[model samples]
Target: MNKIFAKQFNKRALAFGWGMVMAMIIFMSTAWFAFTTTNQKISAEITSLSILEDYYKEQDRLIAYSETSSKLALSQSFYQLAKDSAIDITNSCKVINNVMVWNNNCHPNADFVKQKFLEYYDTNFNSFMLEYPNKMDITYTNVLENTTLISRASPVTFSSEKQGTFAKYNFTYNFEPSIKINLTEQGISLEDFESIYNKILECNKKIECFQKINLENWDISTESQGSWFLFKLKTKKPFIFYENDIENYAPIELNFIIEL
Candidate 1:
């Protein structure tokens, strides 16, 4: 009886040991599978986040390039327009008596020139809008009397002094064949200027021409440079995303002086 009892107890103990070993193996397999799945999910999320970061970086780079390119294009176009207008105005002058003259005056008609400039600018602006669809505005100002006239006269040296000798060169003063009528008041209309200019041109061939022009309100002077006009161009336009304040998101503008 003692021997049978020992054998049974040994068999029971052996069976219980095997059951515990199988349970441990199952638990270890489940834990390892859960850890691997969690690790893979976390790695996938990290990769997705990295891709998003790269996409945003690329977008920022493209936006910066676009803004820089747009500003350069607008600046070039605006300057070219102003330059063309000035050149056209200068071309209207004719050389008379070694000086440039416009309609018997030292400069072109300011009002007329401004009108033509506006017309040409407006026409070209229609085409410019096709490339850059922005509400652009331009302000132009001109000083007609500030124009420089081109002359054909060479520099003349009249006198020179040395250590022991003083020499005087005989130079003939070739007066300009044209006369300029200066009015002090700025209230004169363009018509008044045209009429006065015609009268002055007509008087150049007559003796005692001062009496003919009725110089009670006008002054007389010789024709010279600084009687023409120069203009300024100012252009402004809004940004693509102007609703919010961003760096360099202010209104774009270009300003320049246009000289003929």
Candidate 2:
């Protein structure tokens, strides 16, 4: 009886030990699963935050560019020249093809204006172009319909002590922008998208000739913010009026605003 009782007790002990081990294993597995799930959630959140931060930075940059471009347009001496009919043309052509060259806005290029200036003016276009190569492509065309000249009256003073004078100048043409959006590409991040968008807006604002901007409709389902994405932007710039002939005659100036 004693031996039987001892053997029964041993069996019970063994079963209990097995049960405990199983319980431990189940607990450990549950803990591990919970840890893994939490980790993944944290990682995803981090990624999203990073993307948002990048997007903000890109937007800031674009705004800065816009402001700078606007200010440059306003302060340019060419604005003065455009207002004055006597200085509107370089070689008697209705269009001023090379204001960038004279204003040192662009680099020298193999264009008719450069050739003509070098041949007739006996000046090296390369020097001006070298200093301002990027500025050369800036050009303007007729801004108004059936109007040969536009005038702007700006306050001017010959000397600090002298009374200020108002000068009237005529501009025959203005620079307009033509924007087009290309949607041939694939996925892009939110940051990049915002960057491109802001740039388009800024350019439109700075270029007085831009009349409208057209964009393809965005699909809400696929347009979510992500890295390595693509979109489209398009704009049309039409000369509406001479800068000088703007309804408000005041100092030509540009205002720049940056939002982060």
Work out the TM-score per prediction: 0.34, 0.32
Model 1 TM-score, all chains together: 0.34
RMSD of each: 27.5, 27.4
Per-residue lDDT of 136-240 in model 1, one digit per residue for the tens?
A: 222222122422111122222222222212222222221111112121231122233345445645755343462334533234333222433222212233232
What lDDT would candidate 2 get against the real structure? 0.32
The clash count of every prediction, one per candidate, is 1, 20
For candidate 2, the clash count comes to: 20
Cα lDDT tens digits, model 2, 1-260, are 99999999999999999999999999999999888777766665565566556545544543344333322332232223223211224444322222111221221222432233223211222222234423334222211112111111122111112111222222122222321111122111112223334444465433221223333322211111232112222111111122444533233221111111
* Superposition error at 123 for model 2 (Å): 22
lDDT of 1 at 198: 54
lDDT of 1 at 236: 34
Error of 1 at 8 (Å): 4.8
TM-score of model 2 (CA atoms): 0.32
Please tell me which predicted candidate would have the highest lDDT against the true structure: 1
Residue pairs with colliding backbones in model 1 are 147-228
